[model samples]
Target: MTSARRTAVAAGVLFLITEVSAIAGLALYQPALTDAGYLGGAGADGRVLLGGLCELVLVAAVIGTAVTLYPVIRRRHESLALAHVAGRILEAALIAVGIVSVLSLVTLRQDGAAAGADEGALVAVGQVLVAVHDWTFLLGPSVVLGVNSLVLAYLVYRSELAPRPIAVLGLVGGPLVTASAVAVLFGLYGPAAHAISALPVFAWEVSFAVYLIAKGFKVFPVADRTVTAGGMRPELSVA
Candidate 1:
């Protein structure tokens, strides 16, 4: 396969990893995030620690998706491509912070129990940490993801990298997700409502990823060129 095709496959894999690891991490965190008695118990929950590892993977994959697509995307629009990369990096950083918050809960559990700290206070602190993680989730995955998704969809639409119909899904989805995030932030909507709003964006991403992996980029005029440091350059021909 050509370099562009290779980049597509790599990006698809990273997007898949980003979603899978995020779900796994969140599910694994339940024992710590949900169970109030967990932190007050004798020892730290291993699942929470494992969740942290999964989120670390998520962080890596999030950034990977941005950087992997940067060269191809920059060829179409350089400034927006830079914004996409920066946004993903910021999103990944927020995810890392959320991971740290969850992991700190585990630490609080172990040390608090060992030190004979008040159980009520410990649980309250755990709740605060979980809340921090939840806020980061709202900001990173909901708001930031939405903005970045919109930017990418616009790029793809303009470049004809994928079908315009698929890009439309993102065009619509991004604002919905962001608006829902704002609503949730202000208590106008719940997380469940936000999840429903996010479905379109999810559909857009999944469809895009699958298309890129299977069909590669659509037939375009730029096939003679190749990616370079910040943009694409014409292929060097050896005479």
Candidate 2:
């Protein structure tokens, strides 16, 4: 109904899109990411390209969520809202880099196979591209998302933009995931532990998206002004 309500729903949809695209991209990338000889064969080039496409969609959606929420959050705190947008932009940029790396790897595979290029060299190059993608995933989604979630959660919590439980999830999840990512950077957490740590943040985002979609936003009440003999104008009240 209201513009603010529409914005919340749109942001939710974008968040959902990000999740879907990220999952689809990763699933489609498995052949090149896991198999050492994937680049040698011509079977899965299309699959990897499709994966790259999904990631491009993900990049768009990632930025969309930030942009959609920017106006609402900026009203509460302009600087932090800017930080949220900046963090999401960085994440999207990193995701774009990863997409490019994968696409280049696909090109390498296709051309190398056709030209009778050295299989060893092609595979090595492919692995390097995959490594680039992995780094981007780590830095972009894991690290940057944590900070973005914190900023968003703080704004929502203070402003009552969403339910308190959802905001609390972000508050707790943000620090946990960020710390987990840092530990992963330092080789302190293995794959399983890292995944476990990321669950909280994932839960936060999922719940946030669902709530925004289902309920839009919790409307805060503003003060009603009245005119009298001695007019005393009051500032708008926030809930």
Candidate 3:
């Protein structure tokens, strides 16, 4: 297989890994929220720590995947270098957000209630940390993933090389991702208050993975160069 195809395959695998790990970790951690109004008693704190650690792994998986495909994306879509760079910045920001989230979880875990401490005060602190977790987690990844998705979709639409569905997924999934992230960040809907901010993102990642694995990096061949009247040759292709 060509390098581009190989890169696409690798990108797909990374996406798959990220989603799986995220879901698995979340599953392990969600039960910790069993107590509705408040957070962090002894049992809950331990679960939160495990969950946070899982989240860290998930973030690392995503970053690793992006880094692997960065060169491929640059080569394939030179026109989108700026977008790709923006995506990278967003990715870094998202990773930082994940780190903060994990730290917050750790903090809540460490600060287990003191004897006779006001339960209300503890709940308030939990609420605050959860709020921080919600905003950063959504905002960072949404912008980055959304832009990257648009770029990928455009590239797919323009190039005949990749399976049309992969491009189509990029086009459709990108905006949904951005909107969902924004909704979560802004807490637009009551449901948005939930900690599953990354669920839509997980969907997009999974779609990308499927497309890459199934289609590889199949782009339309660039048209041949031709000489103009002035005898100067320029690269041009018929749309």
**lDDT on C-alpha atoms for all candidate structures:** 0.88, 0.85, 0.62
List, residue by residue over 15-80, the lDDT tens digit for candidate 2.
889988999998998888888877887558778889988998999999999999887777677799
Per-candidate RMSD, Å: 4.5, 3.5, 4.4
**Residue 176, candidate 2: C-alpha displacement in angstroms:** 1.2
- What TM-score would every model get versus the actual structure? 0.90, 0.91, 0.72
List the candidate numbers ranked by lDDT, top first.
Answer: 1, 2, 3
Give residue 45's lDDT in candidate 2 (0 to 100). 79
Name the lDDT of candidate 2.
Answer: 0.85
Candidate 3 ranges beyond 4 A from true positions: 31-40, 114-118, 183-188, 192-204, 220-239
lDDT per residue for candidate 1 within 101-218, as digits (tens), equals: 9999988988898899998899888889999999999999999999999999999898888899999999999999999999999999798889999999989988988998898877
lDDT of 3: 0.62
Runs in model 1 lying further than 4 Å from the true structure: 42-44, 220-239
Please provide, for model 3 over 96-160, each residue's C-alpha lDDT reduced to its tens digit, 9 standing for 90 to 100.
66556545644554565544457677677666766665466556556567767667667656654
Candidate 2 backbone collisions, by pair: none
Which lDDT value does model 3 have at 164?
65
